[model samples]
Target chain A: MSKTVIKVENLFKEYHLGNIGYGTLREDLSTWWAKVRGKEDPNSLIGHTKTITNKILESHFLALNDVSFEIKEGEAVGIVGKNGAGKSTLLKLLSRITYPTSGSIKVRGRISSLLEVGTGFHPELTGRENIYLNGAILGMKKYEIDKKIDEIIDFSGIEKFIDTPVKRYSSGMYVRLAFAVAAHLESDILILDEVLAVGDAEFQKKCLGKMDDVTRNQGRTILFVSHNMSAVQNLCSKGILLEKGAIQTQGSIDEIFETYNLNTHHQQCIKLDERIDRTGNGQLKFTNIQLINANNQIINSVLPNEKITIRVHFRINKVININNVKINICIDNFYGARIAVISTDNDVNFTTNFNNDFISRGYIDFTFPKINIIPGNYTIVLYSTVNNELSDWIKNDALTFSINEFDYYESGKTSANGHGYIFLDYKIK
Target chain B: MDNDEKWDLIIKPAGSLNFNLKELLHYKFLMYLFVKRDFVTYYKQTILGPLWYIIQPLLTTLVFTVIFGNIAKIPTDGIPTTVFYLIGITFWGLFSESMSSTSNIFVTNAQIFGKVYFPRLTVPIARITSNYIKFFIQLVLFFGFYFYFLFFTQYMKPNLYLLFVPLICIQFSIIAFGIGIIISSLTTKYRDLQFVVTFGVQLWMYATPVIYPLSNIPSKWLWVFIINPIAYPMELLKYAFTGQGIVNFTYLGISFGTSILLLIVGLFNFNKVEKDFMDRV
Candidate 1:
């Protein structure tokens, strides 16, 4: 009878980058002592402190928070997630590259992982030698490698270049040889992380076939992670969706994939304010359901790095010459942090004639200069006042756009990082 | 497939220092391949290449003769200063090489650690073995000089105690790996210690009996030399070869016992690191 091969319970893991060079030994010892007693690390849940932009943030984020699942012998499981959704983090834990901050994982058979392409290949070694060397790294013995040497070479289809050093091989050749070695590993359970899509169409099909054989004939369990939805739905019996370090759902392949797709929609709206009542008195109301452009479209929904025009129109019923008025607009990101602001001066003192039969027909318009914000959600806020008294304030949650790709223009940027969120271009060169 | 056989390979990542020798034996071939990679890649891109293995001891011995024998006129316990320093440097370098190579095992191999899983200690264990090969190469050069001096020189003579050289080599291996594992485990989290250890070996050479004879250390602060386990082996080398220096039995026992303790503690921490060192690193 087949067995339940992989069992994982309440597995959790986290990582803090940049500031990791201290306190590792103390952490190692404490974790080691805890594991020996069959107890989880006390500090694993709290995790290490994270730092960003010279600010040490006290909030600890779980890269993989209390995730638990299992695969029966010969069962295939697929994991799907968007960026920063902890998909890779979970594979790392199951592969034992890092221990879980909490929980336990038990595998009752030999486990081999192709977590990254060419993981243990040395450039100095020959393709022939690297096949042996990498096979060893994958936990195959010299004699076991001897038996599969010809098969690995033939499957790779690079026998002509097999005697040359791997540094001389093209990237396609390198990945082919790497996948060949890992695919031939005889372990009872295999875990692959985004490695099936290697070389071209033929190579990927070959790798998929090898994985299929391992599961069907050898009764080996496979946990596969990939961005290809069709492959996940076709190859796996079970599916899991991870979102922001927590498990969103796990179920039948069709069920989890649908759930995964729905949760990954981009949220670009920045601010939640659509109406304004200044001075805490609900006296003056400004409700156009967010300021509209001349076409009456949602304003401020254009690209961040493009010139944008913001226009607001209003109506009045009082007979007054409102000559002391200014329109102020503030910008912010989706996470509720203010970035920039713009306002026209009150020097002009443009008069708005309000009479019993008067209808305000003009709109305030401002052209936003060279936009430099990255691709994310942002908000625009508008304010109107007369004679230094606040009359109306309105903030709108409009989805701001961002463009990708950096063509380096290194003529005069004081802070010339090769790539970052903002680009300061001074000249074409 | 029952629970009895499934219970094999118990990994106690924390607490005690015991290891599963049977599992290590099962993975012996993997160990051999790692050693091969280290030895080959190290000598890959050089002009003289593996010959540097023999050349290092030869060149260092000549420099020792010029500096200590010709300039400072330091006594070599009646042995040739060139031979004395060569052997001392060879043994002392073994300890330092193992320490620095393995001390950053977690940090230096973060890429491989992140991508795959093998026995975690295999790298350090392979490091010690490769250094042992280098030690053997230097030993051959030391014996070549030993034979030449005995036949040609009048002031110095070879002693029968030279047979104990193999035992001294083992002691040196134990000492090197003990210190290295401790440093390797610590440096996984505290990385700059790797830089400190690189030059730390250089500074430590001045404190050990590498360039100077053990007897030449001041009698006023004799206990200072006792902290370095290399001192006992160096003094033993002098006594066993040229029939000079004290071979204190008490000090030798302490050096041997301390090496075992350090290996245990170092392995203790190193095993804990194996679980998720790649994550933290």
Candidate 2:
């Protein structure tokens, strides 16, 4: 077996939430030291200083707590997590862009990270010059960049504009060129953070193929962090899932994915008002959401060819006259790709009666004629706008349901699982 | 202690004051590229381009000669007025540029520094390196005027003290870089210091005897010159070129020692800050 190339022990990262530069170093360090030793803070017990001490002690929260992991050489590991899950913080620590608050990480070789593409790019410089500048920033020697210049330019597919200033290139061209340079980095370990989310679908596929080649053909260890599970499942053999600054699970990619899905699925039945991860103006708020069938029966799951009705109950917290209201429910697959968007504005203005006068509290029902989604778990986003301004929005996990498999043509045949996420009508002669 | 296992790198919460010369040396090419980028982009879209380097100081020299020499009647210690002020401007210009640029290292490079990892010292060192080139250009221009007075006007007496010119330049770069990093480290927390840098250099120029001769200062107030690290080397440059200024060996020694000490403090603070500046920046 290959030796462990990376080892992290009892890592902890804590961030102060409020003002950071107010006090002297001695005061901050002493207070921090006292707290780290689990002793009463030096300022906490003083008479008439209780408020100051509370502010000092309550000002920080841990971003990562007692996290530890090890990776062997040539293992492609995927780090999966929700927002603020400490995944980016872990990547930042590994890349040495920032140091951890405590603990130690030992590594055996040079590590290159693509935290952001074209990190040091100068727009005044031509694309060729930026290549060298960016390459040098990534720890490549001049001669190394010289050797790979032609290959990088060709891979970017913008050879004709290589000598032009990058400020003149379109955003697409810029991202392509930047990713092209980063993809050619020669290092024993590569850490990536959602760098493939840019560019069009074709270029994204090309980047994925190149990354696959990097891991499989070149045998380099990779630590990838992304919300896109399908890409993670495609590239990584090992997986590590993080939740709220702690590791949820670690094992094979399939097992980890199953664990992650189960966690998201558990949140499906949660009440909308109880969901704290929502953002909107308090003028309107979604209170509850339910899925019902054609016979007016509430259901948690639906069949492939069934009529589905999504009823969204909301409350008006403040009295305000609103118009041009649009409500959209976007259904996304497990991979975070949008499958369909059902909007109230698709057919006609449904709120003509309440254009001038608004309802204080009521429910809006959206009924779909037929849902032909494939058999899999999916999530939906709840969004609404009043007069082209966002009034309420609840992103993924606003509601989640699984599609039951059924024979649409009644021939006892099921569609291939990996082909697509939707079913449409067609008949063979 | 895990003596059996050896890893290439070990990262901890706090870093040491140890200077990693090998690591800095390994990134020499990056320093070179930074210097090159600074040189190329300094005047990229301008009409005069590099010519502006010469034009800026000459204009400042002319203004100083008129105001300080002819109008204020400041003595040049028998050296020609134009050459005296030009030499002072050349030296002071480089020193101020190096100091200001060094101090702004954290604020300017915060974008790249936050995302990538390399020697943070390289950026400031590269700024000083490139500033030296601009200094060199202005030095050559000063020489052109010096030779004109020496050979054509015959009002100059030169000596072998000119050999100290390179040493003076090196000391200026070091002192500027040292002070710059210290201020850069502090400014990451207190941004008000950044506003102080520009006028601070201006005030520091007056203390260094850039526009007047050191001989004009009263003997009782000369201790400020003794402590100002740029004073001796800058005085030495004028004395070296014209052989007409004071050169005290003890004060020069003290200046050199202080510069080295300042650099150590700067490096210590800079190393401590660079590891986690992103959080604060």
Candidate 3:
């Protein structure tokens, strides 16, 4: 059995809010005076006299509270969470970038963190020189980087320009070189945070493959944080879900994702009129959205390549005596990547001089002959424009639905889930 | 001991003494790289390049010789005017430059510090090393003129006390780094120190006997200079080279003691603040 490589216990990180902390001479002097007099600190609630819960809430923000976990050697773990969910706070503490308010962390081997790429790259330095400098910053010895210089140059695929100053290289080349250096780092435990968000799609795929190779062939312990669920699923074997500074679930990747989707989308397909998280001139508003099948039946689930119609209802918030109204419904996957767009902007049935001058309430229908989406959850975002200006825009989960698996080709198997987000109708020939 | 040895690393809220000689040894290569970066980049795109290093001290010495020696008629205690001013300016340049740069270590390198982890102390160490290199170049220039005066003119003198010169240089480096890191730690929170650093170093130059002999100060005001840690090393450096200034072992011993004391306080505060500077900076 593999031994435990990382263990963290009861970690808590409390951050002081606003300018009331020790950023001035007066504050520092006051703190020193309080300590000298054996009195409670005037600026902080931590490590001092205990205060009530509400005062603590007002003065301090607990980024991570009572967090504990352990990982064994060669185990790849993915940390998943929304913004401000303490995911980054945990990573920062683990990497030793900052200290926790209370707790301890123990590690049995060397750990390298690629929290960002190209962190210390100097513009005037040549790419080769920068590689060495960046490697040193990440804790590599001189001889170690020297041994891998040629391999690093080869992996970045810009060998011809390796001697040129980094300022002369394109942004793409810069990122490629930075990522190449990080990917070649030899450590028992590697921590990465969305460093693959840059470069082109093909390069991103290459990075994912390299990460997979590291975990499988090299047997390195990896802690990866990313908003791209598909990438996380591809790289990590186990999953950790965090919500509001605490762990909500931890399990296999699939089970964690299932729990994550259910928890976040619990209020599915709510009344659009009540959504306050919207922006626009407020001339028009989206009231409801329904996904209807060919039989005119409402659906909460769908099959691949099925004929469907998305009907959107709207109400006029103000008198819109205008021309050239456009309505667009964006289809986004569960991870918030846009899969396709259904819009009235370029449809033959949409007239060029359309207007809602007198209509107080009405509905528009967009018919898709075959919606070739894969098996997963999706969110619809509604947007409308009047006279080339945004009249109303509603972001995030205007309507939520899931696609169920079906044998579209009669092959007794649906293409493996999450391999791709869309499928094309084609023949072998 | 065996239980503690099982883990390669342990992180906690508070650490002991905050000095890790072993970790500093491991990052020596990083320090070397930082020194190289500072030295090479200082003269990367200039017409004069490293020649400017030589020119800076020469120009300052010429101006001081004319202004203080010729016009103000400040006595050099029988030492030649140019040599007297040159040695003081060169030595002062090293301390002042290192102190100013090291004082800004956290504010300047916050980007790299926020993203990665290394011994933050290495930055200030590298800073002093690089400044010392520049000082060495200027020292060579001073020796050029000194040799000229020695071989061809009657204005030169040499003594066994000159051997103590290296000890004095080391003293200056330690004191500069000690005070620099202390100010850097305090500046992380109180930005008022930011404006005070450059102005204060200038005022500090007058407090020490850099431009004048220690004998020039009245006996009533001598206690003020005695309290300053840098005055001892400054006067010792002058006496070691020219043999025209006062030399007191007791004062030198006090300066050495003060430097070590300041260094301990600096390391403690710097190591404590580095872990959380990201939250404040």
Task: Judging by TM-score against the true structure, name the best candidate.
Answer: 2
Rank candidates, TM-score, best first.
2, 3, 1
Per-residue lDDT of A98-212 in model 3, one digit per residue for the tens? 8887888898889989899888898888899899889998989999999999999999999999989898999999999998898888899999888777778887787768877
Candidate 1 regions off by >4 Å? A14-57, A264-429, B1-18, B45-47
Model 1, A1-429: lDDT tens per residue? 656677667777656534543354565588689878977554454434432423223323568877777667888888886556788877877776776666667777777788876777889989998998888888888899999999999999999999999999999999899888877888887887877755686788888888788788878888888656667776788888887778788888889877754443233232223332132222233433343334556654444445556655544434435454555777764334466777656334333333223225445555556466655545555566656666666533322422333333433533333233455556545
Higher-DockQ candidate of 1 and 2: 2
lDDT of 2 by residue, B1-281 (tens): 33327988888885655577888887888899889889988898899998989999999989998998889899989777889999899988888999998998887888888788888988998999999889888878988998898889766767788888888888888889999999999888668899998889999999997888898999998999999998988888888877778898999999999999998899999999988888877
What's the residue-level lDDT of B252 in candidate 1? Answer: 81
State the DockQ, from 0 to 1, for candidate 3: 0.42
Instruction: Report every candidate's CA lDDT.
Output: 0.70, 0.85, 0.84
Say which docking band candidate 3 falls in. acceptable
Error of 2 at B209 (Å): 0.5
Please give the range of 10 consecutive residues that has the lowest summed lDDT in model 3 chain B.
Answer: B1-10
Candidate number with greatest DockQ? 2
Q: Is candidate 2 or candidate 3 better by lDDT?
A: 2
| lDDT string, candidate 3, B22-51, tens digits | 888878888998898888778877899999
Q: What is the TM-score of each predicted model, taking all chains together?
A: 0.73, 0.87, 0.82
